[model samples]
Structures are given as C-alpha cells and as structure tokens.
Target: MYLVLIAWIYVAFMMAIAEATSPVGSLLGAAFTFLLYGLLPMSVVGYIMGTPARRRAIKAKEAAEREQALAANGIQNAGGDDASVAPNAHGEASGHTIAPERKQP
Candidate 1:
C-alpha cells in the first residue's frame, strides 16, 4: 500500500515539475496540482487502508487492560475453560421470580 502511495507521489512530483517548467504553466498551478492530486488523495487512502490495523490495536489494548485489572484482583487464568470459572458464591437466585398462580375452581 505504502509502495503504491510512494510511486504515485513520485509521479505527481514529476508532473508538478513539468507543469512548473512549462512556459504556459504557473508555479501556483504546479503547487495546486501536487496538493490536490498527490498529497490529498494518498493521505485519505492511507487513512482508509489503516482502519483495520487501528481497530486491532484498540482491541489488543483493551484486552491488555482487562488482563491487568484481573491480575490486580488476584484472578488468574480467567480466559481458560468454563471449569476454571467459579459458580456464584452467594448460592442464590440473583433476581426475584413470580410463582405461578392456581386457577380458581
């Protein structure tokens, strides 16, 4: 991806040089050509292509933070199989449930 961007920038720089050296082209035109065609489009493309890597980095950071919090709480192997996880220590239903009512005879 970066290789393609570098090649495009090189091509644009050459085009800008030609435009600036042309008798009918102004330096302002060359500058605008470089900015609009070369830098602007490539920068946008780079940002778009980098989105997946950014997301992966964010996920890794969050996982590391979670592991650190678990370690601080003296928990280990939190990601292991279900048997490693303990059941609710309180040994009670967590919320109230309504008992079924009997129909009137």
Candidate 2:
C-alpha cells in the first residue's frame, strides 16, 4: 500500500524535475506537474486507503466504552462503596491501602 504511494510521489517528483529542466516548461509548469500528478492523487488515495484503519479504531473504542458501561452497571447494581476500598495495613478499609510492616523478631 505504502509502496504505491511512495512510487506515486517519486513519479511526481521526477515529473516536476523534468518540467523544471525543460527549456519549454517554466517553474509554474513544474509546480503544476507536481501538484496535479503527485500531491492531489496521493492525498485522495491515502485517505481512501486509511478508511479501514480509521473504522477499526472507532469500533475498538466503542467496544471499550461498552465494556466500561457494562462494568459500571455491574458495580452500581452490586451496591457497595466498601467493595472499591482496599484493606489497610492495620486492616482498616480505605480507597487505597499501605502494605503491612513486618516486625523483626
């Protein structure tokens, strides 16, 4: 896919170079060749080729959001703020807990 795009760019670059070198063709003609043959088609093709990847990313993001929604629903249905909390070093319940300190014998 990318190889084709690269080839197109190379062709355009060469076309522009050719136009610039030719006695009959001006810098404007070179610019026209580069734009018409290279940038325009390549831009369109790149966007078209990129559609599938864009779609896949969107779908994956939706799936993630759906999973999050389901998980949130489950947590709400379960009805426990306590469940979100972890037991502390002293066995106290908190949002986050510290590791217990080990006493040396």
Candidate 3:
C-alpha cells in the first residue's frame, strides 16, 4: 500500500517537473498536479486503509480502561454470580388514606 503511494508520489513529482519545464505549463499547475494527484489521494487512501487499526486501538484502550476501573473497585469479575436482594414485603397498605366522607348537616 505504502509502496504504491510512494510510486504515485514519484510519478506526480516527475509530472510536476515536466510541467515546470514545459513551455505551456506553469509552476502553479505543477504544484496543483502534485497536490491533487499525489498528496491528497495518498492521504485519503492512507486514512481509509487505517480504519480497522484505529478501531482496534480504540477497543483495546476501552478494554484496558474498563479492566483498570474494575480492578480499582476490587471487583474480581464483571457481572453474574452475585446474590440478588428482594425488597422487604409487608402485607400492608403503606400510604395515608383519606377519611371517609359523611353526609353534611
């Protein structure tokens, strides 16, 4: 991949040189040619090709952070095997209830 990029850069450089030397071509055209054909495409391709590496790096970093946090909290393992607690249940209505209305005098 990098070899291809290097080859393209070299080709673009030679083309730029040709443009600079040609009577009808200007230095600006050569600069644009190198930038558009060489640097720009290579950068885009490199970034695209590096996506999987970047994702793996991010996942690894997150896993490390999670492990560190769990270790700091003195947790030996993440999730499962813990005892579940049930809320205390009394067979009683808990809240205040309004008084029953009587017929007014």
Q: Which one is best on lDDT?
A: 1
What TM-score would each prediction reach against the true structure? Answer: 0.78, 0.68, 0.69
Give stretches of model 1 more than 4 Å off.
Answer: 78-93, 97-105
Model 1: residue 15 alpha-carbon error in angstroms: 1.0
**Over the full model, what C-alpha lDDT does candidate 3 score relative to the true structure?**
0.81
Q: Name the best candidate (by TM-score).
A: 1
TM-score of 2: 0.68
lDDT of each: 0.85, 0.82, 0.81
lDDT of 3 by residue, 25-87 (tens): 999999999999889998999899889999999998987886687678665553533332222
Off by over 4 Å in 3: 78-105
RMSD per prediction, one decimal? Answer: 4.1, 10.8, 8.9
| Order by TM-score, highest first | 1, 3, 2
Candidates 1 and 2 compared by lDDT, better number: 1
lDDT of 1 at 89: 45
**Candidate 2 clash total?**
0
